[model samples]
Target: MYFSTSTLLLAALAPAAIIASPVDADLTPEGVPKITSISFSGNGCADPGSAKTSATVLDGTLSTSFSTFKGDSSSNCQIHLQASGAGAGWQVALKEATYHADVTLKPSTSLSFFTTSFWSQDASVTATLKSRIDCAGSDIKDSVTVKQSTATPVWSQCTGDAGYPGILNVNFRPAVTGNEGAYNVKSASIKFEWRKC
Candidate 1:
């Protein structure tokens, strides 16, 4: 009887132990958003003479600017970020992007004696996803065009790669007339979401 009781107890405990086994450590973290890297590319946005250069785009500092001016030509400036990956070795989903900039025209170059300066400039920005860690869906992309002289924020949505880390590219452009006026971009950033299993 003693031997039979001991055997039954051991069997009961064995199943419990197996059921309580530890889960894989790799899949522990879920839905964590992280920024991997950031880069800048442009026709002349980084040039020494341009107002806003690649400095702000590369630096981790958000809501800041390397140069106060950002607009010289349409589609001449581009800022790219390799984000959407968490520290747990998994990729997150890119949701949206926010651009921080003060779209005010460069200080008037018109003579002080001039009663009125028709010099005006506007900024038009766009966003797109170049590549993804996994080619599982349509590309994520969006755009926003605003005309303002004060510091205002704009946003773009990620419509692609709903399950993997991807590249986010943003373009900075300025429209000007009547004079050599330019616009400014202080900073740009991306938002990430937890990827689904």
Candidate 2:
């Protein structure tokens, strides 16, 4: 129903009652990440200090799947680990296989990044934690051997507390000889804390 300006003006003189409810308007699915830490969801280049992913550039750059970025299963992305370069360091599973990086993240104190999807090499997958911030950078946070099953790729994770926080990158290596398994990596995450700097 439409009301005339004068009619509406008269209504203005009356006391108005207000109501509040959980409207769908305030509810959003893509709200800022308040989980263990922030995860990026935009930008072609997971730029320095930015947490997000863009489909086109990320797919091309990291050689990873777009499943996670599409919010498919909340996986965010999967490593689909490779065995060919297990010992040689991280090599592309396929030409398309790449890293989904969380860059230039500031830590309040000690921070941790967990791998929801782990790397597997038949029976085992050797994990290596590397600081991708700078090659010269030292301090490998945590690395260990992750157990795997033929059916599911196990998620063994590493943690990097804030030593300096320029940038840190994680890498998984081949543990057993000729394990020839696979690195089905997924749900790479980050967590931050304060150190009272």
Best by TM-score: 1
Per-residue lDDT for 1-197 in model 1, tens only? 01212111111111111313232323323333344555555653566544333332211232214353355333345555554423334322223334433332233321000000010111243223221011123321112222111111222232234322345454544444333334344444343333223
Model 2 local distance difference test score: 0.22
- What residue runs in model 1 are displaced by over 4 Å at the alpha carbon? 1-31, 47-64, 68-75, 84-164, 177-180, 189-197
What's the true lDDT of residue 103 in model 2?
21
Clashing pairs in 1: 31-194, 52-69, 140-160
lDDT of each: 0.31, 0.22
In model 2, the worst 10-residue window by lDDT is: 88-97
lDDT of 2 by residue, 128-176 (tens): 2222211123322222122211111222222123111121122322111
Q: What's model 1's overall lDDT? A: 0.31
Off by over 4 Å in 2: 1-176
All candidates: TM-score: 0.36, 0.19
